[model samples]
Target: MSLDAEFERVSMPLENPFTISRGTQTAAENVVVRVTDEAGMTGVGGAAPSSHYGETADTVEAVMPDLLDAVERVGDPHALHAIESELRAVVEGNPAARCAVSIAVHDLAAKRLGVPLHRLWGLDPSDAPKTSFTIGLDDTDRVREKAADAVEAGHSVLKIKLGTVRDRELVDAVREAAPDARLRVDANEAWTPKEAVRKAEWLADRDVEFVEQPVPAENPEGLRYVYERSELPVAADESCVTAADVPAIADRCDIANLKLMKTGGLLEARRAIAAARAHGLEVMCGCMVESNASIAAAAQLAPLLDYADLDGSLLLAEDPYAGINLSDGEIRLAEQDRAGTGARPAEE
Candidate 1:
């Protein structure tokens, strides 16, 4: 069976400025790829580029044409492992670009089999966990407002962005605003080991679930230091990207946060999950600020995770695709009748 491929760049405006320790962004640059077979069934995927990960829209766009060509040559979308291997051979780095092609192929294969990607992987949607909504770094008042809005929108768990000078104040305000909400914080590699330990103690008093990437990714020793002293569990986001990083940081952090863009695609993410579990670390599936195409693909693997932060698409002002549904913070998979990743272009 012959296959055709196409890709285009998309810019999605964020509902609010997404501020992390690195910087702030009002919009996300994504590359969306689609693969269609002779039968005209199309499977779509998207890449949300992050400069922190050494990926950007221009970089992803630059590599996709050749990557898509390679995908076309492979012909059989069901051969996901071969397709991913072929893509890896064509380029080094550009995990986001490779993720687009890999997911598109998996989407196509799952659609061809007339099943959702999760079921294709022998996963049960009933086992999927609730996802957390994120409140980016902002002033205390705005933080309170966002927390309230998230709660009103049915989010029971809130992931707050820390690392600001007013980290304590921000959490205080958010806590007051949503007293019953479960809180988690991501420092985005902004704190030192000492600061992380101090902050973790403070956060634990306020019921924060965990502290993520409290220290820099390059400082495994620092992370270990913080983890040993932290009153709360420490989850490694930046430090644990692919499966290989898992073993090294397994003893340092309590949990490993896996994102598709970081792992390259669902296939590798599965390996990352297994690797984390093998090391006796909990797994959390995460995503960059992305459209539903990528979020939907990630949602298919939610059952394998101990936690979910798959609200990247929910933070967008206008998402082009529609896939997963969230209700009171719980992620609901598409009906079993729905195929592929259970995502499709939103009706214009």
Candidate 2:
């Protein structure tokens, strides 16, 4: 039952400069984690530390030694619950670092069971929704071009980054480019309550499905104000970080957007989903910019989600690891042939 664990930092360039209301990212900094059992079976996971969440690659690397120590001390990869508890105990704040180990161990455990991670959880892959391809903020024309290209590439769902002075113009351009595509917009907490409501009116008129995080998390009342009046459904991304945050946002948002990096691990993400559902909210699983090492693991939870944004690796200029076949935005989980999270070095 002995296990060996290790990690490595990776810097992956984006296919394009990804911009949100908060800022832009040209690259994704990830730390890949590997957990190997006595039988030489290895599980892979990744930490895509986000500075927005008070985590960076350096922070993840700084804490890996203690996290791995906790894993080895626990010694059994199958003891996932115990392992997660140990990881939490070892590092109180580094959810990204803890998430890396969590993914790796889950991957290993699933491999040992000779099943894909979703199958291990007994989820029906057919229920999984097609993922949304994100169109990061750019000039209106460029945004339109990206939307058209995405539709041509078979992406029926597009998540557009909003929160600019010309939000209406950008939405107009995208709608013109892909009139039939399902559109969702994320303001990333960039608007005032009244402004969000006004924008939401026009956004709804344009057939946008939902408006995500229209106001800052700090202004709970503002979020509730917009949610109570917006023409479109509201989804809480920044406000709903963990399971504990769900109940507070339940009355304010129609959807709870959970990210693995924000929730820390697969188990915690599940808990958050359950909590959100319990509070009568739909669930969406999102991701930070990441490699397949982590995105693959996130994809395993697709069946349990109402929405999916697991396109992190797809946005990468090149991903050294490959997992899942998200051809044309369909999360072809049942089509996968490998065990575990299906994440492995691409060279393999």
Candidate 3:
């Protein structure tokens, strides 16, 4: 295999506003990668920007120039592996940029091997997995409306964003409107330990599925406290990014929200599941406001996870590709046989 390849970035703009803990995100763009071998095979890859992972877009945009320069310099896709040790060196450990580079390289490698992404990860490509549709923080009435719309739109389970003064109200309203809907809540580090427990108890009264990161991650001891007292199953978000963070917080919560942007990429994220399961923690594959490229990468990890929260793409105004077929909250595989979250060509 020869090394010479070309690199470029394609931005996938979102169609609508994605509301969350941070704020309402109006648009999203992903950096795309193409790898070419001397024998005439090309692989496609995509990456999300940092805003979703709590980093600035400028940071992610800045990271690509250096990463692409190095990739082009390496020449061969196989040689790209040699340059990977320097992956985090350029992105400074930003999961979005690194995730993009990682998958781009995988797409190149998968095409070389002539196999689909799931096969590379030892999973069946045809199995359909259901993902949870999100209900962002809104008016109690609007929360109920969004919840109803999600259910009517084919979502069996829903994840609602909470963690402000309206937390209890929104949860109660949603439960009232969608009584039969399975639900989960994310506080996004909006409450204190004492307050989180109180909120957990409140959520339990509404028969909510579970509360995620009700309190700050800085004090996992509070999570343990709430877990011990509340009837709800506690899940960790923004707290369990790395495998190293798993052991310390695994006992404190029952589930973890794993995002490619946070865990770095599919390779590392694949490793996190085993670590979480060993510590008796479930996994929730989630994302920031990104295109199908980002979600496609996370979809491979969804089968290994107990809960799937990969709805970031559906919230977009327009999707770039038919990356994953999501229906009734279930993700239908796209090019599942290809390696590293089989992403189809962007131009297609």
Candidate 4:
């Protein structure tokens, strides 16, 4: 079957400036991809490249032609393994770019089969976990307000961004606002091992479920140190990028946080999850600030995740696409009766 591919860049304003330990962003720059077969069936996906990962919209755009060319050259949507392998050979470091093509191809393949992406994989959507709504770093009061707002809006799980000196105060504020919300914290590799341990003590008391990337990915030993002593479970985000990295982090963290943008494709993401599970690590599927064009594809993996932080689309001021239903933070994949990843232009 002949295939045609194309892409465009989109800049989505955030409802609020999203801040992590490293920095803040008021807008998310994404590259959206579409792969269409000769029959006119189309699949949608997006790349929200992170500068922290040495990729930007410019970089994603720079690499798209080659990535999409690889897709067209494969000439078959269901030839996922071949297409993904070729994508890697074409571009070594543009994980986000490759991921966009990957998601698009997967979407198209599933669509051609007239099934949801998860069903294509034989996953039971009922097994999917509820996703966490993130409260980005802000003033303690604003954080508390956001937490309250989230709770009022029916979010039962919340992930808070922490790394400042007043981390405890921020947690305290969130707990005050969302006392019943299942809480998780992401330091984005901002803490020292000792500081992470110390903070974990209070975070544990505050009933935080876990701490994510408290220390930098560069310090594996330090991560091990905190993993051994910290009061809360530690999840490795920065340290765990691929299946290969899972073995290295197996002894360092309790959970392996995998992102589609980081792994470069759906197939690589599954490999990472399997590798993490084989190493006795719980898996969490996370995402960059993305639209449904990609987040919908990520949602297809929810059934396989122990934890999910796929709230990327929730942070956007407006999205031009719609895929899955995350109402009240429930990844309602079973309720979405659409084919493919359920990603379609918003107007649809």
Q: What lDDT tens digits, residue by residue, belong to model 4 across residues 98-215?
A: 9999999999999999999999899999999999999999998999999999999899999999999989999999999998899999999999999999999989999999999999
lDDT (0-100) at residue 259 of candidate 2?
Answer: 95
Candidate 2 collision pairs: none
lDDT of 2 by residue, 52-81 (tens): 889999999999999999999999998999
After superposing candidate 1 on the true structure, give the runs of residues whose Cα lies further than 4 Å from its correct spot: 334-337
Q: For model 1, which pairs clash?
A: none
Report residue 118 deviation for candidate 4 (angstroms): 0.3
**10 residues in a row with least lDDT, candidate 4:** 322-331
Quantify all predictions' global Cα lDDT against the true fold. 0.91, 0.93, 0.72, 0.95
- Estimated TM-score for each candidate: 0.98, 0.99, 0.89, 0.99
Off by over 4 Å in 3: 3-16, 51-54, 72-83, 89-91, 125-128, 334-340, 345-347
lDDT for model 1, please. 0.91
Candidate 1, residue 153: how far the Cα is off, in Å: 0.6
**Candidate achieving higher TM-score, 2 or 3:** 2
Better of 1 and 3 by TM-score: 1
> Measured by TM-score, how close is model 4 to the native structure?
0.99
For model 1, residues 1-348, the per-residue Cα lDDT tens digits are: 899999999999998999988899899899999999999999999999889988899999999999999998889998888899889999879999999888888899999999889989899898998999999998889999999999998898999999989999999999998999999999999999999999998899999999999999999999999989999999999999899899999889999999999998778999999999999999999899999888889989888999999999988999888887864667787454578987788892
Clashes of 4: 0
lDDT of 3 by residue, 2-39 (tens): 54434445555554455667687667766665666677
Candidate 4 collision pairs? none
Residue 340 lDDT, candidate 1, scale 0-100:
90
